[model samples]
Target chain A: MTKRGRSIRVPVLARVEGEGALEIDIAGNRITRLDLRIYEPPRLFEKFLEGRSYLEVPDMVARICGICPVAYQMSAVAAIEDAFGFTPGPELRAWRRLLYCGEWIESHALHIHLLAAPDVLGFESVLDMAQAWPEVVERGLRLQALGNRILAVLGGRSVHPVSVRPGGFSRLPGPEALDPLQEACRAALETARDLVAWTASLDLPRETQDFPCVALRHPHEYPMNEGRIAATTGLEIPVSEFEAHFEEYQVPHSTALHSRLAGRSYLVGPLARLNLNRDRLPPPVAEALAATGIAFPSHNSHFSIVARAVEIFLALSEAVRILDDPPPAAPALARPLQPRAAEGFGCTEAPRGILYHRYRFDADGRVQAARITPPTSQNQARMEEDARLALERFGLDRPDEELRRYAERVIRNYDPCISCATHFLRLKVNRR
Target chain B: MTTIRIIGLGSPFGADRIGLLAARRLAREVRLPPGVEVIERDRPGLRLLEDFTGARAVLLLDALAGGIPGRVREVERSALLARAAPLSSHALGVAEALALAEALGRLPEAVGLLGVETGPAPGPEDVDPVWVQALCLRVPVALERLVPDRRVAGCGGRIRSRR
Candidate 1:
């Protein structure tokens, strides 16, 4: 008698930021196929962006994902400014960096506490983890709030901020605003430090892969809104040169386009950023990283949590540094803009990873075309690779439920923003 | 510390804009009591806790899908969390946030989700006008329910009532 077709399926990927699924198939103790599917449906954000005024692009693109709206806004503003040959003054740039720090802290905190930690601790959800570790959950909430506080001060509110534009912000916060934000950050520093320590203490599973890592590289500081795209494989390219070397091809299984560099999958996000810029971290964060006893350039994706925690520490320190020297009380908005027909590219390191945006503008500054490549879409191919590798390493004969959970763990390790990967798919494993 | 926070939740696109529209209408049509703060949000998700923290009460207005078009429903937090799955595609949604708040003990003394049914409307304008009017009419009623002429200990030891 022949074994019938058997497969494992996760119809709805849970504990993730967006919608996705997973499926695997095995026959006679051998895994046949693994599909890391992201079927969230195409949002047509690129199409929607066309014909919109350049001024509205920042706010409009921010809606791409609630978790990292700032990333979209930052990339949009940068690209638009690039097209117009404008760069913000040092103070304005620092403010943008500070805002980016807030997003990192907030987004990373949410992932560490709510999404990833539960899997490491063997709980179903953060709510479940709270039952036994209330204090841990409380600290996470406080830290999350601290991150939001920074955004509220800088962006005007946490989500879909109304302040950003092509040239500069709508308004600049003065010393008075800076005082409270600084004070609040000061209070939260201890928690941020403790959170890093706590994350590092988790018994992380070690599964190292030799995949190439990529992120933004800046000479003087960690990359956020501005930097050259660097890869561990010794590839360095300006943001403008992104399309020249990399490609995003549509797969029938996913709404998101699978991205590759020189026709091969690469990893991005926290792990990649840390791998590329460990030495550039602030001294305090560097000290914290050393204390964790984890080696630098960790190949284990599980260490991504540590990368995020380290980022939170760095963001907090940077937030304090920026706040201490508040911008002048002069009007916060940048000089009036003069929009002209142009094409531009913007790339930034979101909390999750690198986000890229390209836009073409009509003579009147209306968007003629737009292309956005979110971090998650770039990570999709790598995620599928990891799932297959996990099954191979963990054993194909494991119980179906156990394998499913393990796959979910691997997927969540990337902290995928399925909404951002609107071009996502469902997962399925097929047995021969 | 603010005693009352009214948060209108939704995006600005299509039918999802109702929460924001209703919020703006309430802000203009009704006079807020001294301690109440009205805010508009584009899907704050788990950040709802941050918005509602330290408040004595919270009234969340949102455009709800999968119900009668233009119908309004006032739901208790407990009922909402009982089926605590995400209602939106973009974020964790209100139910999961409320559940997290409940588990963390950060919930206010009173919380209500004012759901305005979007029905089959394609866009903001397509939604029945009656839904908007109903939301406006229910704002005061919800406020009264939150405060209700009672002094509750969870309200930070302040004696509070609606004007």
Candidate 2:
């Protein structure tokens, strides 16, 4: 018995959402071991937010991840607003929903067109894909740009745009500022329809997985800003009861904390949402998704690209509707947080999936403990399993080039954002 | 005869990856007296080390995007080693693929830095005005170090913040 090839391990991965690794033991059968670790140090916003002024929660906890800054902002604002006990006015809610739409559009497009699509199309990186499938890459850039444009119009620059506070936005976008967004949203809706159709047209392998679906469930609309945590197995609970239902276990083999529902593991994000609330999707978006020939409860993880494309259409359609009647000028926030020892739960549908944050603030505002559960962290285990499943399904006898793409596909489904400690995405600073 | 390899970090299309562009300009100005090689390796790989073997020194240039905007980190090999393992795997990023070189102890003797700060702007792909400006100031320093008495005019906008 000979110990085959060298064992390689990545303790921390780059160009991703959080830390993860790939280790392979190639004997007769290549042991493709992939662990999507969430290496982000726990800041414990939940314990820290125990007694602090609730208002400071947004700014303080927003540092969790750059990719979904607004998600954090929205969750903190909504929860704190819930505690202080006031719902944002109808107009404010519409504006908040609009901002969320931009995040979904941008993040979903990024995952689909840039990260995942390249892998499916037989390219190592998007840069490689750009040479052969120029049109596809262009479409991604255009769609991503549209998403970015929406963020900029409402908030500022797409990455960590400054807008949306507890009560509302920092400063409401002027009517004209929203006008171009309206136009862009209208055009993007059509673009998204085409994108979804195009994505469905790809030859996707099928798998039948019975993983429990986890997502926020809304009565009237698709989940985004607020809803109870619901499972496809008929389990529904408030976000505060999240811990009661799910537990995060620390594994020495990986950086990310693995999550499980009580005694079982579950899946979330795009697939989960579509499965749970396909009927709630807007008419146009739903029709576009159906046109893609994809159905709900799609166990094939690769179908996430189709799910993302469908969400992009929903985002565009929603954005246009919001822009049709912009929220009037109003102070971005409400009264400063009232300080009292308390625990508050916040959750939102990030572009990737459900991002949960719990803030326990001391009487003043010093963060006592913060638990920021990013969507990527939750998806880590599933990603690793997907990689192994892909290898087993495809047979490791195939070339690394072909197998590697599917490996990347598993990772892309989580839309891993390696920087969960910091709340921004795709930041490149140039000081000349 | 020493060889220098300039591997571009970050997505070239991204608003980062300007470090590669700066390294390219420096490679043009600081030609070896006789036996020297320049390589613009894109992305990450183990083959990048083939250029620096038996060389007196190597300068790895790339982009860094963090902190108070216009700040440069003159990182030493040791500083990078603390981040990486066995000192050799720190070629590109420690968190990425490195254990291959670390076990071999095949690290270059001398390593230099030409890291340029990119402050939330468009990065260098074909060419960018912002990256070219920073390179103008840093390129001369690089050439002076590699080839003494060699001089080259800086191009890209009027030079300022020359650190």
Candidate 3:
């Protein structure tokens, strides 16, 4: 092969949420650079939070991501509540967990069946995939609807739910309301199981790499809205210490910030959660994972789809269990919140990974400072590293189109949410 | 639980708010049929599909990007279904949502869309009064189109171009 410099540019990546571009430079079989440019203009959500009352944070932040509004709401409210030293009663806590599960199932199903599966099945898009696998697509949509129903039941509506507030929900759902949701989850559980089996049957590439897996770890249950931040690198810290352990810095090529733990890239999201918290999975989910035969502690990021499928199974099952034991009806909002000068930190396992929120409030409870680290930004550095490693393993001499597709698959495996991260611009391939 | 559901789909940001403004004006200025209801939404996608269930007639109002700014147009459900193939970048497009609802057998008996043309997404300050007037002028006529037999009695409002 002649020694020549080459570059692969994906002007815009499809199937994943938000807008992003991938650029790879190769000089004579040696990879030179891989940049995942998230050129979407910064929405400046944190800055937008300034001067807004604490009561408005959840709704304002929920606008940050349409796909996972509940994640933003959960993390925002938890952090604000931490500032006020407030905790919902057991009933509200259980409902919060149930809401989180609904988000997980909905987000994971969308990624697995609609976004990521097309790349694995070698189709252009989910619509194309649906032609060959209509049943699978329908199942995914139905599951997604079920997840939305959960949000609707508890939060009042799917997108930007109205019920979730800082202390608790605006309204608590009664036992009778859970009947249809429970039945739906039962049916979804079966479909989710079949989904897990189907995804496992796919011959996904097995290329495991060593990276720090970061997520929240609870004492006895799967991490949802509460836990200390834990990493496979023997690092554990309270959510309050997140600012010290992790930092987000920006690059000129992308508008979104890249995150690092102790000046080094790390990983989060489904792969991290599954690897770090396998012990916390419910019995049925554990059984399903075992049945897949894909070993735990999977390094091959491609198995993320499989991991997501397992989570869908877990979420539907969890929803059923939550509904089976309904919380007694209680007022959604706690007593009138009193504003004080305090700072609080909140970290929760979003559908993608660990989402961190910190807030500083004045005596009036107006926001003085706000910091949010979405999972996508946290994974940006790691995603770039994965791209470099994948290119090296796949061969630099691969055709541009092949390389582009490979890069897309590698990025989609992380399921980046550029929309939820910074915002959208456009992706263009400047093939020089 | 009205048989005739009128939804205004929009975001509060800039020109996107035209749909919401039109729907609000209609709800206030017009005395709609006995079983008619009007709603304002911030941003809607597939969720709009579920709103179609059990309705005898449905009329949607939204802002259309990539056209003459402030221009109003009436789009039919069939046309929306025809163009639903390529999904939009933001969540789900209206055409795709309608198509999905149709596929799931949830579309109502009569459905229509009335919208104003908008430019590139503007900030909050870009709520064009001209665009608001354009859509408002067409809402009552659009509603009549959706519910042909129903007596919708609120046509003599301030902005009565009827186009």
Q: What are the per-model DockQ values?
A: 0.22, 0.04, 0.14
**Model 3 clashes, total count:** 1
Better of 1 and 2 by DockQ: 1
**Which portions of model 3 miss their true places by more than 4 Å?**
A1-18, A39-43, A419-432, B1-8, B12-42, B49-59, B66-70, B76-91, B98-112, B118-163
Residue A191 alpha-carbon offset, candidate 1, angstroms: 1.2
> Model 2 lDDT vs. the true structure?
0.62
Q: Using alpha carbons, what is the TM-score of model 1?
A: 0.86
* Alpha-carbon shift of residue A244 in model 3 (angstroms): 2.4
Q: Between which residue pairs do clashes occur in model 3?
A: A11-A427
Q: Worst ten-residue run, lDDT, model 2 chain A?
A: A1-10
Query: CA shift at A80, candidate 2, in angstroms?
Result: 2.6
Ordered from best to worst DockQ, the candidate numbers read 1, 3, 2
* TM-scores, each model vs. reference: 0.86, 0.68, 0.83
Candidate 2, A340: how far from true, in Å? 2.5
Kindly report the interface RMSD of candidate 1, rounded to 1 decimal: 12.4
lDDT measured at residue A394 in model 2 versus the true structure, 0 to 100: 74
The per-model lDDT (C-alpha) reads 0.78, 0.62, 0.78
